[model samples]
Target: MSVDLETVKRVARLARIAVTTEDAERMTGELNAILGFVEQLDEVDVSGVDPMTSVIPMVMRKRQDAVTDGNKAADIVANAPAAEENFFLVPKVIE
Candidate 1:
């Protein structure tokens, strides 16, 4: 799981990152350690374990679906730079 300097340089290039020689050497060691930990995780056994969303289970809250316009047209159009016929006016861009 050792990452060489060349591999690190290639990774940096692929990621569009500029790296100095010193930083490349440091990153190679850090990346190798991370890969080693991932390799170690591969040795663990977790057969038949069910995936879980959370440790504690609870029902989600539900609400009734109601549709109604809460009249706020005056408040909404108050800050417009230009408004006509109760609607914001803008420069026409399409023919």
Candidate 2:
């Protein structure tokens, strides 16, 4: 698809960018060039190519989904003025 001068000006206005008529005219050509390049990319044969997240071949590191209470409860409450059973005992605030 090709971009026209009006489309460029409309897009600029929608994006809240102030563009003069000359700039819009210039951007219309530039946007058309970019779209033409993207269209050319669609013509390439890439059915054999596999999509990947990284360039380097590596195994994804994974950990076990084991559930645990994360034994740091006692350590976290160590600095509290009053803590019992790995819990902080706070004074009642509501009347």
Which candidate comes out best when scored by TM-score?
2
| Candidate 1 lDDT, 2-50, residue by residue in tens | 8999999998999999999999999988999999999999998878877
lDDT of 2 at 48: 100
Which 10-residue span in candidate 2 carries the lowest summed lDDT? 52-61
Candidate 1 has an lDDT of 0.88
Give TM-scores for every candidate, taking all chains together and pairing residue i with residue i.
0.56, 0.63
Query: Per model, how many backbone clashes are there?
Result: 0, 0
Indicate the TM-score of model 1: 0.56
User: lDDT of model 2 at residue 75?
Assistant: 86
Candidate 2 lDDT score relative to the true structure: 0.93
Q: Write the per-residue lDDT of candidate 2 for residues 5-79, one digit (tens) a residue.
A: 989989998999999999998999999999999999999999999988689997888999999988888889999
Worst 10 residues of 1 by lDDT: 66-75
What's the lDDT for residue 60 in model 1? 61
Model 2 TM-score, 2 decimals = 0.63
